[model samples]
Target chain A: MKDITEKPMQQWISKDNKAEKALKRVKQNTTARIGIGRSGARYKTDAFLRFWADQSAASDAVFTEVTPETIVNLGLFEIKTKCRSKFEMITRPDWGRIIEKDQQQILKEKCVKDPDVQIYFGDGLSSPSISANAEDMLQVLKLGLEHEGLSVGTPFFVRYCRVNTARTIGPLLNAKVVCVLIGERPGMQTDESMSAYIAYKPHPQMLESEYTVVSNISRHGIAPVEAAAHIVELILKISKAKKSGISL
Target chain B: MNNSEQAFISAGIDIGTTTTQVIFSKIRIKDTSGFGFIPKISITDKKIIYRSRIHLTPLTHENEIDALAVKELILNEYAKAGIAPSDIESGAVIITGESAEKRNAKAVTAAISEIAGNFVVAAAGGKLESVLAGKGSGAMTLSKKTGKRVANLDIGGGTTNICLFNNGKVEEAICVDIGGRLIRIDSDKISYSSAKIKECIKNLGLNIKEGQNIYNNNIVSDLETIASSMTSYLTYCIDPEMSLPKEWKDSPNTRLSNRPDIITISGGVADCIEKITSDSFAYGDIGILLGRKIKESTLTNTSFYQKSDETVNATVIGAGNFSFEISGSTIDYRNSTFPLKNVQIIDIEIDNTASTIKRKIEQFCSEYQNSTFALAAEGIKCPTFKQIEETAKLISSVFNFPEYQNKPVIIIIKEDMAKAFGQALRRKLDNNRQVICIDGIDCGIGDYIDIAKPVASGQAVPVVVKTLIF
Candidate 1:
């Protein structure tokens, strides 16, 4: 890690930005990344470097791995999709969705059947997100659901998991509401952001609109713990309505 | 598309030095997040459903507020609006200016709120009045919209509340004892003069006093001079570089660090800014004359002058509409009992070690011994789970105090980490006590926070923070 200046973007004003003080205050409440000064017609060196670095980091996140130790640390058993490796997972999207017969047996034997809610983690696009947020998010979501007296199924890890894997997992485990916390495709703003895909009574024939999604869960965004609490509340809503996503 | 929205009946009552006013508003809250996203609740709409006529604040004695009479007045407003006391869900009853100094000021405010309805806040102070008037008058919006510095002078009977806004944010709210009705007149004579006005008369060698004939040459001319000086003091407050009169030197609360691009006027005197008649003593007070002075002063002539959207009902309207805010949706709380009023806050730097943070919390609890306060902190941009666990341990340690065991432990932070921090805190408490951890509220020491019952399908709580400083 480099010791770099992480000044609140609002305070990074150029010497002659004229609106320096106003820009600083505007930056505090301002959501957009504006006021980046320029040299001639091009971005200033700092702005160019930052933009370049963030984009590179986003692309690089796709190739990373969620370490085995992290899975052990979180007390989650690991399972894999039909896709053999990261290369195959990215190239064959359909293969990444369906769990194999062997994995289905593992899920049936290891995971509780007919649970009110089933929550699991997957390293979909940005493995760093799972490594960064999985522990805290799981801790809050698990405790919050159990506190509400809802029976939650065994939590586990899915390698090369696509979001639609919930369609297969939900039917196999008899989970009324299936939730998968997966890494979102990295953006310039954050590579450590995750999304939670939840579905009620998911099946192989289910439509994409049947799943509810909460995206941008990270330290710089909604925060994993906050997102987890929100997920718990949303799960309750889905349970009461007997539906999720657009239908509910 | 499926949409859900909840509307609340709000009431705002202001008892000031000269007049009392009440306003009712319908505030609607809705979850703005799209179907798949997490809930983001906000006050979607606020409309003034009813605006009560300005009534002379009932005073039992010159030095005492008539609490019973005030209660009757609010009840009368409720009847006139065809609303019941039980209908009001949010809003505030604020006592402002010289009226707040009355012997029974606190009792009068309390009595008035009791009749208005539950959750109608009873607060009295000039600074709070200053902020409210600015927001209500639309001066704050003007600055925010134009991205320029704006200041509002709510020139009431006994005080002028000056609120400075920079890019819509309050820079500072300064209240001064310069207003229209500091000296009252009736039947061609000076019927009353406040202590501050008497000092001004003596300082300027005007020779004005109670019972002085208003028709006399010196009395009428001297009063005009006093009004002229009062308007200049307001300008001096805005731009300290101006020639400040000798009279205000003792009251150093006049100087401002930043100059405003525009000055908007509110309160009763705002209605009389343009001349209509020659009679100055028509209201049996110096209000009309002072308004005339403000209209004639350089304050009106400069580019820095703008008329506010409201005139007489600024404070009440502010108390009604702009007082309440919705907490962030992703907060953490369980076993909740809400509508908690007057919860104070203690702000500490987040970078400080947990032990150091605990010291600040202990000091605040000791200082504000009678009240339960929230531990408010600026949060780390992104904290590791280990960091959250460590901090939660320090936060839960505050429960060691015997009194805090049963009461809800509240923690408010500026970051969006309340859910994680709150979960960790619950683990530390073993779910034995109620814990309220909400984020996205920025507050500091001495601020009184009011938390409403959860709304938007229990995803968030409606909140109002009052700086009730006299």
Candidate 2:
């Protein structure tokens, strides 16, 4: 089914078009669809099918769940937000942001406290992103921070998660910084995209402006390993600036 | 919180066969990225604030460039423009035309660049000059904007540099020894004539030499013929359909493989093309005569011909505004300083096997001893994390041979994978080696790269890739 959308964008332009060379050159810089020829005032069959495939992929990404093996392999025990299922997490966004009191206690007891940086993975909208990118990104990120002579706290996974979970985790664990590597809402160009929402000394009262974001982390975008390296640098900056987002 | 803007002063100095010129420009870089996105820093504008008066190039009796006089000229221009050397940041110092062949050309350029700016890189060689002139003459911008093939002929005093740009990218560039000042007439005598132009004169059944009187010996028609010959040589270099004479087939020209849709002419000789002079020897050279011939030639009548706004200042303007390029937004660097210069690029193909890659690196290591060179390649496309790790492992084998163990290992990838690759490679090398891996920079073998300080809030670095090819 991906045959339609899987072809390189540079080669997707119609062969007979005289502007194929120019179109191919422009395609190298962007991911948006362009120069897809029309047929009788409608998208060509291939273009239409590619669009449909991308749409379906986005929906599939939202509904699916990360496999148990992925969680166990990452060497992290699982915790859940207040929401129990995907439907509740989508309908009640507030509930999706909170960790239960018992789980918070467990997080405090099990996780390292007073660390310079705390990293966590969240399958927000796309479960596939965590299973795909978390291990590699976390490896690079931990090594990068450790190389900078900063202490990195334990990593964990939170199911049915949202971005605001970092606000709670940072204060509960007495961490200086909290960075959530979470799955992003899928777009037509890619479904595997993820984002890193980083904040300094986060708490329930922190404003939205306090969170510094580095988004579009995936193989199709900024490769996870690369994004992780950048995130490591950002964490170091936050420690010096003593702030993130607009202030930093 | 909001978009950030950074502006810096840049200086460009061009020492040519007939003239020496300098220009100061204000280059502004802007962060165009919106919230929730990575910083996308780009050079937003380049404004030429001051242009120096073109001066005659000082030459020693030995035909070498008078380095002190040239340095003094540049320093005077800087003072006149009210710019301190410390105010300038990034630019290029280029030696063009036949002056680049002088015995002291390299030393002169180095001295000028050192006094010009902290980050100014001294650059020469015909290929970089051709591209710079094309950029400065506005032909390259037009091609990029219109998506048309544009070719520029920068006809200076002792050499004509030809570069063809296809939709804003350099296709090919060549420099030919066809210019106006190759034969200079002083009042009633031919003061100087190069050996090559003398051979050209002999081909026309004329005996011309240095220190010969030519005031009444039909010099006008002979000079016209010579100017027309030079014009023909330029056309032969750029136009695919224009065949050279039998003897000129093996001449000093690197012709464009594909014909351009538009053509532009610039440089000192180009300054004379727009106007005709009653006195042909006004500049004590055939520059005006050559311009008159080009104006009246069939080459100008072609529908593809376009007049360039910048004539004498094209290469200098290009040096000021176009030498630096931003690297990919996502890159990796550690324990490195700004402005690493003259690092040779060793382009290698990463084959499927690691041993084959090791052998290639071994060859490069032996070939480039006592020098710093980066390993560059068009890396894997949309590589998985595993693939990136494997490729990094393959490249880390360079450390096995002691040539790359302690020194800063620089890797340039054409693909957008340097961040991931650098991270993985750093891990393989025990997280302590100074690894600088960058991407979205396109450079090849026989080219040298210079890296400037981090810009766009440290998202990327500025790089100057100087290519030298015949």
- Mark the regions of model 2 whose C-alpha exceeds 4 Å error after superposition: A8-11, A14-18, A25-34, A37-46, A101-114, B1-3, B247-250, B349-369, B381-383, B387-406, B419-435, B456-459, B468-470
Minimum summed lDDT over a 10-residue window in model 2 chain B is located at B245-254
lDDT score, residue A53, model 1? 76
lDDT of 1 at B328: 80
**Docking model 1 quality class:** acceptable
lDDT of 2 by residue, A115-137 (tens): 99999999999998887789888
Clashing pairs in 2: none
Judge candidate 1 at residue B370 and give its lDDT: 68
TM-score for all predictions?
0.90, 0.91
Instruction: Give residue B37's error in model 1 in angstroms.
Output: 1.9
Best by TM-score: 2
Give residue A222's lDDT in candidate 2 (0 to 100): 72
What are the RMSDs of all candidates, in order? Answer: 3.4, 3.1
Q: How badly does each model clash, as a count of residue pairs?
A: 0, 0
